[model samples]
Target: MYVPKNFQEPDRDTLFQFVRDNSFALLVTTGDDGIPVATHLPIELLPGPDGKFQLVGHLAKANPQWKLLGRDTPALAVFSGAHSYISSSWYDHVNVPTWNYLSVHVTGRTNLLTADETLAFLRQQVDKYEVHSKHPVSVESMTEDYVRKEMRGIVAFTMEIDSMQGAAKLSQNRDDKNYQNIIAELRQKDDTDANEIATEMAARRVDNGQ
Candidate 1:
């Protein structure tokens, strides 16, 4: 996450919102062999000590990646938001093509939770994602015995984020006219991802006081 001053997003609220909106993230760690491993999981971000952040997610007990966390190993959780291809045609002929995106990298020490802690973590995730739904579900509705049994199938852990870096490269370096053209072109596309990126670009313009 080598974010230039212009592209860096240091706002805490902005980074948290990005994580919430794009909750599916890549959890990366180094295996026992010292090889990097990545697992794609839907994560729930929670407040940590000293106004920091923590990431909670579960992986199958069968997933060997979880074994790397017992000793407070370092890990990274990467949350990627909307991104799309930007055509050079949207800019002047001299301009080259590029991709526009928003991403946050959370680096932290990983800790595997105990069985009881893991159950609570899973409950929190269900509450977070389901509370706003039209038909909200509750862990209480499920038999306590059954819930305990189910928790055995997965390993839950929390990453207490030691540092976080966010980058939002949304065509800010482009001239106003070129940026507007890029937004317009993106809006014309049927892909929702392109349209979402365009909206973010427009919002970034306002945030930068451009």
Candidate 2:
């Protein structure tokens, strides 16, 4: 989250889109014993009545992390996008190796959703992903008794986003000569993540009118 001026992504829309693309995020909260607990889950962002973004996700009922959720409790959702290792050799000039990546950190207070609200969220979440399937299965297609029994095994909560910080460290600090070289080398690699970081760097260049 410690983003430098050159790497910081200030656009709210961009950050929200990044979250949507990388919906499976890390949720972090501290316990009473001061130990941090994290859960990896698919969290969706929705607009609230006050025009603010809220993150919604569910955890297994046995997961103790949900116990940390409260109106006053602080929570962090971390969305990690494409990332790749940048070799110093790829740079035209002499430099140390580094990482090029995109990430967004959201901080807010979390509250547990009501049972009815949780069910609605579940149905919506199911539809969101199932739409891509050839044979999509929906919550409404299931028996009411079965759905209710399944819902009882999870806890759903929402975090009203108070702040979001995005970092797009795609070698923006490098000069054009080195930047172009980085992308070229990344594309030559067989790694998908490397190719994605290269694509992002090229897109950023276009955005900056370079």
Candidate 3:
């Protein structure tokens, strides 16, 4: 989250879009003994009337991590997007190797939702992910009794994110010659991460009038 000025992404909408595209994130918190715990889960972002973002997600009932969701415990959600290694060989000038990546960190207080709210939360998640399905399923498709029984096994919570920071280090600090060279080399790789970072770098060039 310590983003240098040139790498800091200040656009709120762009940051939120990154979260939506990469919905799965690392939810971290500290326990009573001060041991840090992290849980990986998919999340939904809800914009509040007060212009705050609420991160919504559910954890299995058996997961003790959910106990950290209280006003006393601070929650940090981290969403990581494309990342790739930058080989010094790709740069036109002599330079050390580095990595480029995009990520966002959100810190806020969290609270568990009521049972009714949890059910609604699950339905909303289904709607969001079922778009690609030819036969989309709905919570209404299942009996209320069965849904209630299944809901007992999970804990839903929402974090009203008070702070959010985004970093997009896609060779923006490099000169165009070296930047374009890195992107060209990266695009030659078959790896997804490499290709994605390359695409972002190319877009940055267009934004810079290169």
Cα lDDT tens digits for candidate 2, 1-210: 689999999999999999999999999999999899999999999876578789999999999888899748779999999899999988766789999999999999998888888888988899999999999998889965688899888999999888999999998888898899999999999999999999989988988899
Which regions in candidate 2 have their CA more than 4 angstroms from the true location?
none
Rank by TM-score, highest first: 2, 3, 1
**Model 3 per-residue lDDT tens digits across residues 77-159:** 99999999999998766789999999999988998999998888888898889878999987887866788899989999999
List model 1 lDDT by residue over 1-210, tens digit each.
788887888988889899988999999998878889999999888865456578888998899888887566789999999889999988876778998888999988878888878777777888888888998876777766788898878888888878889998888888898988999999999999899999988887887687
Q: Could you tell me the C-alpha RMSD of candidate 3 in Å?
A: 1.4
Error of 3 at 195 (Å): 1.2
Give each model's whole-structure lDDT: 0.86, 0.91, 0.89
| C-alpha-based local distance difference test score of model 2 | 0.91
Q: Rank the candidates by lDDT, best first.
A: 2, 3, 1
- Best-fitting candidate, measured by lDDT? 2
Task: Give the lowest summed-lDDT range of ten residues in model 2.
Answer: 45-54
Candidate 2 global TM-score: 0.97
Off by over 4 Å in 3: 49-51
What are the clash counts of all predictions, listed in order?
Answer: 0, 0, 0
Best by TM-score: 2
By lDDT, the better pick of 1 and 3 is 3
